[model samples]
Target: MSFMPPWFWLLLALLFFSALAGWVLQRGLKKQALSADANDVQRQANRRIQQQHLTDLDQALAEGRLSPAQHAMARDDMLRHVLSDATAAQGNGMRPQVNAASAGPVRVVWIVLCLAALSGWSYAQLGAAQTWWPLPLSQRVQITATTPEQLAEQTRAWQQATQSRPADAQAWLTLARLHAAQNQHALAEQALARVLVLAPEHDLWVERAQMKALSAGGVFAGEPWQWIQQVLTAQPLHLNALVLAGSAAWSEKRHDAARAYWQQALGLVPADSDAAQGLQQALAQATEMPKLAEAQASQVVPVLTPTPSGGDTRPLIQGEVRVTPEVQSQIGAGASLFVYAVAEEGSRRPVAIWRSTPTAWPVRFGLSDSMGMGAPPVLSSLAQVRLVARISKTGSAQKQPDDWQVELEGVKTGVQGVVLNITGR
Candidate 1:
């Protein structure tokens, strides 16, 4: 066998001795108590039965079924209805019946001690208390842990630590989180309690409440709703939380909520942008689209401003006509330029608001304003469009050509949806 720790071995030795001692003591007690109970029982039997019972009692006494003195005591006690079940004394009824002259407190103390020890040893002859180690206590008395021993240690340490320094509420809260994650529901809740005790402020209360409610053993199934109320109570516009709460004004379909969030995002972005693109989708599905009806109402109204006709009637051979960055509208090179407009939407195909007269140093090499219209281009519908803009580098649309294409290269700058491409040579 493996060697045990010093304490274990000592414990085993102590227990073995204690067990032997207890066995002897208990056997004696059992015998004494049984004897007493038998006496009591016999006395009771005598008192209750008529002379017919005397036969049984006489026979029991003769057969040694009952001790003579025991029988006499039982018989007397039964007749007088008095209890005479005291243990046998050694010398006298009183503590050694000390003489008045010698009855010092010290002597009395000695006599008392002797009587107590005698009583205890005599009592053990009948029955005894269980044995246990005095110095080394039971670790089993400690808290629950991974294993019985481990749990005992953990419990012991926790108790000892708590005795030395009470648990902090923050510490409890963190422990609660860890336990909750582990599905240690009860432990998690206990930790949460500590948290509340330590920090009962509104924020902490709310946090504790959330953990308690959401905790496995916690009221989670019931708490998320209450937690939601708190979150909204503090920050109503919390995007995701509120969204999750359900669009109160609307149904489960988060159209309004989604729209609002998307709009919020869209406002901070540039047009023709990815955000704008997303917003466009949002608008399509928004309930507030009607509220924003004015937005789309005018959106369909085409973005083409009328091409301002210049006084020039010349097929002006202009310098390089460069297109505007985002919108493919052309700005002239010289002091003068022409302009044009295409019908709305598709306008037969991708038509320019207007084309510019040719020149050198076109920032874009190929047919930058590139998209092909069929053989003879047809207007998409009666849509307003940017035909062209013939203008000077001075940012001026001079009134000069009346005969040339008299286009926007010959017109004023206004709203125009120019369809142009730089790489589509």
Candidate 2:
């Protein structure tokens, strides 16, 4: 349920109370005016009676029925009575005026107090009182800090919301996107899995496959490959799936397959688009290479190695990844560990990537030009590079919260082997 802002309700209450106070003051003024009018009528009646008495006395004196002393005494008595009645009427009128004036202010004070109490109570019950706090200017700067605290908070909120509304596929999809962006691939995959369960669609499956490939550092095999295959089976010309399939084929050195997939993708994309331009370049490069025999196209390309008799003598860097006992317990079964070399400058793509199981900690690996992801600018071409060893519980090379990682920077190519410790960092 959506809630209104406290200020909105407060303003509404103020308007309502002001209207009510005005109504009370208006009623009081009307009553006071009526009382004053009644007092005036009574004063007029008393003057009339006094005038009649004087006329009666004058008539008696003119007829010689009353003596002069009697007339004077009667007039003086009527004057006293008339004066007393006028004084009483004036007092009655003033009392109502004073009470009406005082009633307005008193009623306003009471109304204000009541409205304030009601506002407080309503806000406490309806608003986010516990979470609400004043955000000072000093605290605003910290919100932009490059740490996982804010992301973690958002993840928790999304998790709670997803749990509360399990049937909300869009919420689950959004949660998946958030987790994926934060490099929480395991949670992200879990959320996507939920979305698939709730609402299975071609685009979602393709997205899942893309995430799978990204988590594996652009390698698509096993389950990730199957995801793309499923989408292609349903819709062969699906743009995203085709692109991912092409990338996977390229990574595996299946140039013919990659070319075919990319050509199909190029057809779907706009001719002037960046993707089309890149695909055109790749296609041109593929056309220059000798065509593979049909039988070779169906088979996986074998990793060629130099024979001991006449092998290429380029140097190779050797390394071992070590995991501390404290962090070893945190590593789950089937978790992937990536040890790779990236160029310090120009195209930070991994020159060579090696994957290992978490249980095989302290495993030895070799980095050479032969292990390069693609042709050109191999490990030997770069004067220096950074060697990174990461333990990915989500199987993603991207860093996630609580992942163990270690890097050795400025390591010269063809140098002595270095040891990297995958301690939590």
Q: Which is the leading candidate under lDDT?
A: 2
Model 1 lDDT-worst window of ten:
366-375
Q: TM-score each candidate.
A: 0.20, 0.43
- Against the hidden true structure, what lDDT does model 1 obtain? 0.39
Candidate 2: pairs in clash:
none
Which candidate leads the pack in TM-score? 2
- The clash tally of candidate 2 reads 0
- For residue 2, model 2's alpha carbon misses the true position, in angstroms, by 33
- Candidate 1, residues 1-425: lDDT per residue as tens digits? 23344445544654565555555655654555555556656656655674555566678899999999877876775545333322232222322222332333344455445555664565457533223222211111222233336544554455455455565543344445445333344565566567656654344434444445323211233554465457657765543333323322122234566456445545656788754664454445355433443453544322221221222121211122344343233433333333323433221122223223334323221111111111112222222343443343442222222312212322212323333222211
Weakest lDDT window of 10 consecutive positions for candidate 2: 303-312
lDDT of 1 at 359: 49
